[model samples]
Target: MEWGMHGWGMGLIWVLVVLFLVLGVLAFAKYLIKG
Candidate 1:
Protein backbone atom coordinates (compact mmCIF):
# COMPACT_ATOMS: atom_id res chain seq x y z
CA MET A 1 0.00 0.00 0.00
CA GLU A 2 2.79 2.48 0.85
CA TRP A 3 4.65 1.77 -2.35
CA GLY A 4 1.55 2.23 -4.42
CA MET A 5 0.86 5.62 -2.84
CA HIS A 6 4.45 6.72 -3.37
CA GLY A 7 4.29 5.84 -7.04
CA TRP A 8 1.08 7.78 -7.48
CA GLY A 9 2.56 10.85 -5.81
CA MET A 10 5.53 10.78 -8.15
CA GLY A 11 3.27 10.48 -11.14
CA LEU A 12 1.27 13.51 -10.06
CA ILE A 13 4.43 15.58 -9.62
CA TRP A 14 5.64 14.62 -13.09
CA VAL A 15 2.30 15.60 -14.60
CA LEU A 16 2.40 19.01 -12.90
CA VAL A 17 5.96 19.63 -14.10
CA VAL A 18 5.04 18.84 -17.67
CA LEU A 19 2.00 21.09 -17.51
CA PHE A 20 4.05 23.96 -16.11
CA LEU A 21 6.66 23.64 -18.85
CA VAL A 22 4.06 23.68 -21.61
CA LEU A 23 2.39 26.75 -20.15
CA GLY A 24 5.72 28.55 -19.85
CA VAL A 25 6.47 27.95 -23.52
CA LEU A 26 3.08 29.17 -24.61
CA ALA A 27 3.38 32.31 -22.52
CA PHE A 28 6.81 33.09 -23.96
CA ALA A 29 5.50 32.70 -27.50
CA LYS A 30 2.58 34.97 -26.79
CA TYR A 31 4.86 37.61 -25.32
CA LEU A 32 7.08 37.55 -28.39
CA ILE A 33 4.12 37.89 -30.74
CA LYS A 34 2.72 40.82 -28.78
CA GLY A 35 6.10 42.55 -28.58
Candidate 2:
Protein backbone atom coordinates (compact mmCIF):
# COMPACT_ATOMS: atom_id res chain seq x y z
CA MET A 1 0.00 0.00 0.00
CA GLU A 2 2.11 2.84 -1.24
CA TRP A 3 0.95 6.27 -0.08
CA GLY A 4 1.98 8.46 -3.00
CA MET A 5 1.40 5.64 -5.49
CA HIS A 6 -2.35 6.29 -5.20
CA GLY A 7 -2.14 9.88 -4.23
CA TRP A 8 -4.59 12.75 -3.69
CA GLY A 9 -3.97 14.17 -7.12
CA MET A 10 -5.50 11.18 -8.87
CA GLY A 11 -8.52 11.30 -6.58
CA LEU A 12 -8.98 14.98 -7.24
CA ILE A 13 -8.92 14.35 -10.98
CA TRP A 14 -11.64 11.74 -10.70
CA VAL A 15 -13.74 14.10 -8.57
CA LEU A 16 -13.53 16.77 -11.22
CA VAL A 17 -14.47 14.31 -13.93
CA VAL A 18 -17.56 13.29 -12.03
CA LEU A 19 -18.48 16.89 -11.33
CA PHE A 20 -18.25 17.70 -15.01
CA LEU A 21 -20.42 14.76 -15.94
CA VAL A 22 -23.07 15.79 -13.46
CA LEU A 23 -23.03 19.35 -14.71
CA GLY A 24 -23.27 18.16 -18.30
CA VAL A 25 -26.34 16.10 -17.56
CA LEU A 26 -27.97 19.02 -15.80
CA ALA A 27 -27.25 21.29 -18.74
CA PHE A 28 -28.76 18.84 -21.17
CA ALA A 29 -31.86 18.59 -19.08
CA LYS A 30 -32.15 22.35 -18.96
CA TYR A 31 -31.80 22.53 -22.73
CA LEU A 32 -34.52 19.99 -23.18
CA ILE A 33 -36.78 21.92 -20.86
CA LYS A 34 -36.17 25.16 -22.70
CA GLY A 35 -36.77 23.61 -26.10
Candidate 3:
Protein backbone atom coordinates (compact mmCIF):
# COMPACT_ATOMS: atom_id res chain seq x y z
CA MET A 1 0.00 0.00 0.00
CA GLU A 2 2.69 2.45 0.96
CA TRP A 3 4.72 1.71 -2.17
CA GLY A 4 1.62 1.87 -4.35
CA MET A 5 0.60 5.30 -3.08
CA HIS A 6 2.75 6.94 -5.77
CA GLY A 7 1.82 4.33 -8.39
CA TRP A 8 3.78 4.81 -11.63
CA GLY A 9 6.33 7.09 -10.04
CA MET A 10 7.50 4.31 -7.75
CA GLY A 11 7.52 1.84 -10.60
CA LEU A 12 9.49 4.24 -12.78
CA ILE A 13 12.07 4.79 -10.08
CA TRP A 14 12.55 1.06 -9.63
CA VAL A 15 12.91 0.51 -13.37
CA LEU A 16 15.49 3.25 -13.60
CA VAL A 17 17.34 1.93 -10.60
CA VAL A 18 17.51 -1.55 -12.10
CA LEU A 19 18.61 -0.22 -15.44
CA PHE A 20 21.33 1.86 -13.87
CA LEU A 21 22.61 -1.08 -11.85
CA VAL A 22 22.71 -3.31 -14.90
CA LEU A 23 24.49 -0.65 -16.92
CA GLY A 24 26.96 -0.06 -14.15
CA VAL A 25 27.83 -3.74 -13.98
CA LEU A 26 28.20 -3.98 -17.72
CA ALA A 27 30.42 -0.94 -17.84
CA PHE A 28 32.60 -2.29 -15.07
CA ALA A 29 32.94 -5.55 -16.87
CA LYS A 30 33.84 -3.80 -20.06
CA TYR A 31 36.51 -1.79 -18.29
CA LEU A 32 37.93 -4.92 -16.72
CA ILE A 33 38.04 -6.67 -20.05
CA LYS A 34 39.79 -3.72 -21.67
CA GLY A 35 42.46 -3.66 -19.00
Q: Please tell me which predicted candidate would have the highest lDDT against the true structure.
A: 1
Model 1, residue 1: distance off in Å is 12
Please say which candidate is ahead in lDDT: 1 or 2.
Answer: 1
Clashing pairs in 3: none
Off by over 4 Å in 3: 2-5
TM-score of 3: 0.78
TM-score of 2: 0.77
Q: Give lDDT tens digits, candidate 2, residues 4-35.
A: 84778788889999999999999999999999
CA lDDT, every model vs. true structure: 0.96, 0.92, 0.93
Estimate the overall C-alpha local distance difference test score of candidate 3.
Answer: 0.93
User: In model 1, which runs have C-alpha deviations exceeding 4 angstroms?
Assistant: none
Model 3 lDDT at residue 7: 85
For 1-35, candidate 1 gives per-residue lDDT tens digits of 57698899999999999999999999999999999
Compared with the true structure, what per-residue lDDT tens digits does model 3 show for residues 1-35? 66565988988989999999999999999999999
What TM-score against the true fold does each predicted structure earn?
0.84, 0.77, 0.78
